[model samples]
Target: MNRIKTDWTKPQKLSLVALLFIIGKTIKESWVLILYFIVRAFVKQNEDEDDTEKRSDKLIYFLLLTAAFLIFFQIQKFIQFFKTRIYIKDNELIEQTGIFTKKTKTIPIHKIQSVHLVQNYIHRFTDTCTMKVETAGTEKTELELSAIDYLKAQDLQEILQQKEAVSAANISDNNSTQLMGLSNFDLIKLAISENHIRTLSLIFAFAMSRLDDLRQFFGKKTDAIIDEQVNQINFTTSIVAGMIGLGIAITLAFSVIRVLLRYNDMQLTANQKGFKVKWGFLQTQQKMMLQNKVQLISWNSNFVRKLLGIKILRFFMVGENILKDDQYIKLPVLQEDVLKKLSAYYQPVWPSLNENPNYTHPSYAWRVTMIYILPVAFAASVALYFWEPWVMIIPILLFLYFLVTFKIRHMKFIFWYNQTSLQIQKGIWGDEHILLNFKKVQHVALETSPFLRRKNLATLVLHTAGDSIKIPYIPLTKAQAIADRCLYEIELDKS
Candidate 1:
C-alpha cells in the first residue's frame, strides 16, 4: 500500500485559536491570592481615598494577564500545526502526532467499526472535512483525519467501508435506494415535537452548579437569594413554576436549535450491503452501518411527538460511530408508510415474520408491582413516619403510580420471535418497538428470583453487543425453550 500523508486545513488554525480562548475562559482557578494581595495593599496604605484606585489597577492587571494567556495558547497551536498527520498502512489504521516526543497509534483494520465523514462550518469555507473512525476498541475515536479535502475524505470513507465489508463478508451488486428523508416541513414538525425535558434538566443542573461556584468566588451564600425568594410561595409551587418557565425557555430556542443543527436535511438509505445515515447543517456527518453489525433497532417518541404523529428511529450498532449526533444511526421523524417500508426491507431478510406478537400473560401485571413497587413504597413510608407525617401522602401517591403502570404498561407488553428476529414492544409515553436480528445475539440467559421460582416464572434476558432486553414473568419452561431456539438460530447463521 502506498503511504498517504495528510494534515489539518489552513483554516483549522483559526479554529484551534478559538478553541483555546474558550478553554482558557472556562478553566477554574481560585482567586484567593489576588484577593489577599488587594486586601494587603489597601491595609498597608494609610490613605483611604487611594484604596479604590489601587483596586482598579489590580483588576486591570488581572485582565492583562488573562489576555496574555489567550495569546500564548494561540501561539502554541501554531507551533503544533505541522506535527499532526494520519495515514493508512497494511492491515492497520495509523495516526502520528506530537512534535518532539512523537506519539503514534495503530488500530487493526478489522477492529474498525465505522468511519464518519464530518464537515464543520470552517471546513465548508475551506472545502475540507474530518474523517473520524470508530472501533470496537478502547479509544473513543480510533482515528480522526481532521480537515482534509471534502472529496478526498469521501473517497477515504469508501475505502474504509470496503475494507470492513471485505472482513465481514463481500457485498453483492445490490442496488441502493433512498429509504426515507425529512423535508423542510418535516424539519418543522420535528422541531415542534422535540422532547426538551432532557435538555432543560441538563441546562438547569449545569446553571445551578455554576451559580454555586460563582457564589464562592464572590463570597456570598449560594442559597441566600433562593431563601429570600421562597417567602413568596411554598417550595413545591416554586419548583413547579421554575421548571415550567425553564421548560418553555429551553423548548422555544435551545431544543429547536439542537434539532435543526443535528437533523437538518437528514436522509437514510440502504442497499444489500447495509444502511447509510447522513445529516447535519453546518457540519455534515455520515454513518455507515452494516446490517450484521446492528444489534438493536428501537423506534420511540415522547408524548409531544405522539401528538404530532411522528417517531424517532434509532439503531444500536456493535461499535462506536463517531458522529456529532449522539445516536449513531438515527432516522428522523418517520411515520406510517415509511415504517412499513423499513419493516418490509428488514423483516423479510432472514425468514418468517409475525406482525401479531403475543401479549404478556395476565399474571405479569400484579407480579411486576410486587417486584418493582411494594418494597420501595414500604421503605418510603417507614422513613417518612419518623420525620414528617405529611410525607405519608407520598406512599399513597406511589401506590397509585404502581396501579397505573401495571394496568397501562406492564400488562400491555408484547413479545414475539421467529427464525430471524425477536420483537419487543413496550412503552408508556409513546410506543417503543424493538426489533433484534437473531444472528446478532451475543448471549442469552434466564433469571429467576425466589418469588419467581415459587410462581414458576422466569425472566428471559437477551444480550447483544450494545444493550440487553428482558421479558419478565414468563413461564420458566417456555423461557428455556425460547432461549434454546435463539441459540439454535445463532448456530445456524454461523454455519
Candidate 2:
C-alpha cells in the first residue's frame, strides 16, 4: 500500500472555528437588535416609522458584515497555501512548512508508540480523517497528518504495524499472533453484562439534549421562536409533561436498537503480535495495538454494573492517549467473566494473585471522617458553652453522620507479595485491584511520618515501569525490609 501524506487547505481546517466566531457574533448582535426593536415597538411613540428605518439599517449592516467575512476568508486561504505539505517515508515521517522561515521535522518509526485515526462529522461526510502518530522517546515529537483520505489513514496504520513487527523481529522475539474475530457469544456477553444498551441510551439522551445548544450555535437565528414556545406552556402543564417515564422507556428501547445497529458485526482479536478492533454503523474504524507495547490494564464499574457483575476493561499502550483520559485501548462493553477468559490469551504472563493476612491499612473513610469530625466536635463544644446550648446538638449530629458513613464504607486494605508479583487491594465499594510483576518495578521507597515513627510504622511505595503503588501503615521494620527486597529484585533482574 502507498504511504500516507496530508495537504490540508487553510480554510478547510479552520472552517469550524470560523463558524463558531460567526455564530457568537450573530447571537450577540441579534440580541441587541431584538432589544432595540422591542423598545421601538412598545416603549416609544411613532413605533411604525422607527421599525421601518431600523429594518433597512439592519439589512445594510448584514451586507457589510458578509463583505468583511469574505475578506478574512481570502487572507486565511493565502496563509494556508504557503504553509502545507507533510511527507511520510518508510522509516520516518516529515512535516515541511513555512511562511517566512521554513521548518522540517523527521521522526523515526522505531520510536513511535501508537498511531490514531480520528474523524469528525465534517470529515466523515467528506470521507477524510486525521492521523496522529506518537513516539515514546520524546514528549513533544508528535506527528499530525490532517485532512487525508480515509483509505490513506488505514494504509498508514498498516505501514506502522508492519514496521513495528519488523523492529520486534530484529530484537529476536518471534511470538506473534494475528487477532481472531470476536465470537457471537462473546459479543452477546459484552452487550448484556457490560450494560451496552444502558450506556447507548445515556449517550443518545446526552446527544439529544445538546440539540437545543447546537441549533442555537449552528442553525439560523431562531432564539425568539424557541423562547416564545417555551414561555407558552403553563407551569402545571409543564410539570405534568416533564414526567419522564415514557422518555425513559423510549430511551432504553432506542438505546438497545442503536447498540445492535452500531455493533452489528463488531470484532476484536489479538495475540502476541498485536490487537485489532473493528466496528461501526456509519463509519468503520480499525485500531491496532502491538502486544509488546501494552503498558497497563485497568477495570472499572458503577454500582449497578457491580451489582450485575459487569466490568469495563481498558488497556494502555506505552505512549498513546487512545482515549481522552490517556488510555490506549478499551473494550467498551465486556462481561467480567468474558474479560477473565480473554485476559489469559492477551496477557500470558498475568501476575499471580497474592494473599496476605498480615498486611492492612486504615480505610479511606476512617481517615476522612477522623480528619474532619474531630476538629468540628471540639469547636462546636466550645461554641455551645458561650452561645446557644443547641450548638452541642449540631456537632453531635455531624459527628454521628461521619462515624456512620465511615463505618459503612471503611474496609481493610491489603498488599501482598509473591516471588514474581505484587498485589494491592482497597475500597469497600468499587474495589481497586492492582497487579504488577517484579521485573516491571523501577524503584522502591520507604516513608515514615512523625506519627508513624511514634507508632513504629511506615509506608512502602513501589515505583513500576508505568506507575506507582503504595502500601501505607505497615510496621517500620517491615516497610524497610520490603523496600530493600524490591530494590534487590530490580538489581537481580537487570543482572
Q: What are the per-residue Cα lDDT tens digits for candidate 2 across 191-229? A: 454454566567677877787777867675556666898
Estimate the overall C-alpha local distance difference test score of candidate 2.
0.60
State the TM-score for model 1. 0.75
What digit string (tens of lDDT, one per residue) describes model 1 on residues 376-452?
Answer: 88889889989998897899798878778787786558877765677877886577878777777778999988878
Q: For each candidate, what TM-score against the reference?
A: 0.75, 0.63
Q: Report the Cα lDDT for residue 467, model 1.
A: 75
| Model 1: residue 460 alpha-carbon error in angstroms | 1.2
